[model samples]
Target: MTDTAPASSPAESPRVIALVDDDRNILTTVSIALRSEGFVTRVYSDGETALKALLDNPPDLAVCDIKMPRMDGLQLLQKLRETSALPVIFLTSKDEEPDEALGLAMGADDYIAKPFSQRLLIARIRAILRRSALVRGAPEVENDEQPAEAIRRGRLEMDPLRHQVLWNGQPVSLTVTEFLILEALAARPGVIKSRNQLMDAAYSDDVFVDDRTIDSHIKRLRRKFRSVDPHFGAIETLYGAGYSYSDG
Candidate 1:
């Protein structure tokens, strides 16, 4: 009998990740760690260079430093928000609550403290990429019937498959974290979801985030929705309980 050996599957191309940090040590260390996990990294010393590189050639995700010389991470994120929905994870060195809150409010997917473990970073990266891939239809859902492409509740419409959101027929731009949080809340309207529950849904693999992080995302979500509908009051907060979505 002729011997038949099964051909091995080709190796998949590594995902590109942009790393923006003023510290050379971080760039080197993080890049090496990421490379070992089969991720291609493009490191930048400042936000300006990173912004230019991202606008010209976008990456699968970006890890940015909160403080940098000329064009800080917050400023760069603001600029990027004006055009693209690039997923960004802020790297904050200081243990300041405001800085972390601001970053999350400004649409960062996640944040990590400076003295963080490489394993945690890798886990967050994988979690985000998996969610994004699901939206992009990679290794699609295995079911006899296709899942609904869009979920609509009153004026708000969310298309999980397309990774798109619309309020009153107008498109609303949201970061990966924001979208995930909103999706979780909207999935079951009028149900109060505690901070812990929200965190479990949006940031299951995220290590450094806390309850305040979910609150920040909720505040930002309200601002975004209200901007579109001046009288928007969909997301309701129960003081002692948690948060719930109200179509009315």
Candidate 2:
């Protein structure tokens, strides 16, 4: 295990992100990048080594590679989900849509393909950290003026502050991206939001994700809700326009 502290002054406790990968180069480079951004990091060589530490002393979030020696990222995520809701971002090989889809369905917050840009990863890290902070009751740097209120539309209830979602009174687990997308739609029931609009809502201005990413997230969101309520159909898809939420 390699741990690196933030480069910035310690005014408050810096957010901790665990990096799990078999490649030594990735661990070293990503750790340096995160440290420079004032984020403390802990790196593990494989998922087996990572799982114990991750559960014992959970980080704010984790960035894990899908392919590893002993335990794979998918197995690790499955085990982690049994006990924790810790945010996770998967690192996958390019064109591995099945793995990406599986990871999202298994509760990964997001994924970036291998040979990815460090800037994009950082942006994603910051995004997930911000959402995790909201769930942990940490003060949000953006939109502090706006109240963090619980949103209720028919059988769907979302607590932005707690980052909790309930369908028909049963709790449903959602990744940060899923939560943001759902929040945007449920915030205004019956209003259609284009793919671009949903992307803007879920990701930062600097980061770019394709339409399929949004569609995949939407699919996972519906699956999650349906897991709790078999008749869940609040989210409506318009053939060529976009998606809308209809509580009625």
Cα lDDT listed for each candidate = 0.81, 0.86
Instruction: Summing lDDT over every window of 10 consecutive residues in candidate 1, give the lowest-scoring window.
Output: 1-10
- lDDT per residue for candidate 1 within 1-248, as digits (tens), equals 01111133227656788889899898888888887777888889998888888999898999999889999999999899878888888888766558888988888888888788999888989888766665555554345323346779998899877788999899888877788788878889999999888887776545546777888889888888888888889899999788999877
- What's the TM-score of each model vs. the native? 0.89, 0.89
lDDT of 2 by residue, 75-120 (tens): 9999998777789999999888799888877778888998899998
Model 1 — TM-score against the truth?
0.89
Q: Residue 142's C-alpha lDDT in candidate 1?
A: 45
Clashing pairs in 2: none
In model 2, the worst 10-residue window by lDDT is: 139-148
Residue 158 lDDT, candidate 2, scale 0-100: 92
User: Which candidate number has the best lDDT?
Assistant: 2
Candidate 1: give its CA RMSD in angstroms.
6.7
Error of 1 at 72 (Å): 1.0
lDDT of 2: 0.86
